[model samples]
Target: MPILVEVSKGLLTQEGEREVFPKIAAALLEAHGLTGNSFMTPNVIGHVSVKPESECFVGGKSQSLAVVEVTVPAITFPNGQVAQKFIGEVTDIIDTYKAKPHPRERTYVVVKHAVDGPWGIGGKAYSNADLGAAIQKAAMA
Candidate 1:
């Protein structure tokens, strides 16, 4: 089965869209041993989208955060443990990029998944520690 990975909205700064996305995508491709036109293959598809934040005022004011969505196919292994390992591997990549210092201060990185058929993997909200742990676990797994 194919899997989709999506980045959450408001998770990325403008700089992230232009800089982080490509680097992350490329890292994923390399990790999977995929290159060039291989990104078009059916088993995996990586996508990125962004939504603007909104605000409203009622009795109180509420603000909506912008989000960035990244979707990629999930790679399955023979067992649950292996599957988790695979997820961990991908998660590590996202974490690494999230930890890198950037020019913007209002940026975050998250992972999410699709609920129905053609299910996608979501990168969870990541901090440097979270990313580091995930990377170490995946690498050691």
Candidate 2:
């Protein structure tokens, strides 16, 4: 189960690189109890990409969101039951970060399950607040 975790921080603040991204990643890995090879294992491949928050927009509106796109191979779960569990586990991690008190701006964190075989699970738009909840919900379903 190669799970790819892609993290992208918005340019909403200058401290995103120095503070936000590392915090999010640390929370995620800790929540999963993944260490050593387990953390790097192909069961889940994680990637982090950061950019200025102003660049992300929707409907002509600038979205000051730091997006963390999580992609996991659908085949890894085989059945919906397993998929749900996996999703839930990841979601919990995101939720923890969302609960943190920080700037008033919106930061989107999304978890996308590659349903089309091994490569189709793309990224989704998520907020720092919704990251964990969304991922948990998707996995439990």
Question: lDDT per model, in order?
Answer: 0.40, 0.41
lDDT per residue as tens, model 2, 1-141: 232333324332344334444444444444343332331232334444554446656457654444455554332334665445544544444444433342323434444555443232235443333444544554455
Per-residue accuracy of model 1 over 57-120 as CA lDDT, tens digit each: 2235333222233343333132565434444554544444442332222323334432333233
TM-score of each: 0.33, 0.40
**lDDT for model 1, on a 0 to 1 scale?**
0.40
| Error in Å for residue 72 of model 1 | 11
What is candidate 1's TM-score against the reference?
0.33
Best by lDDT: 2
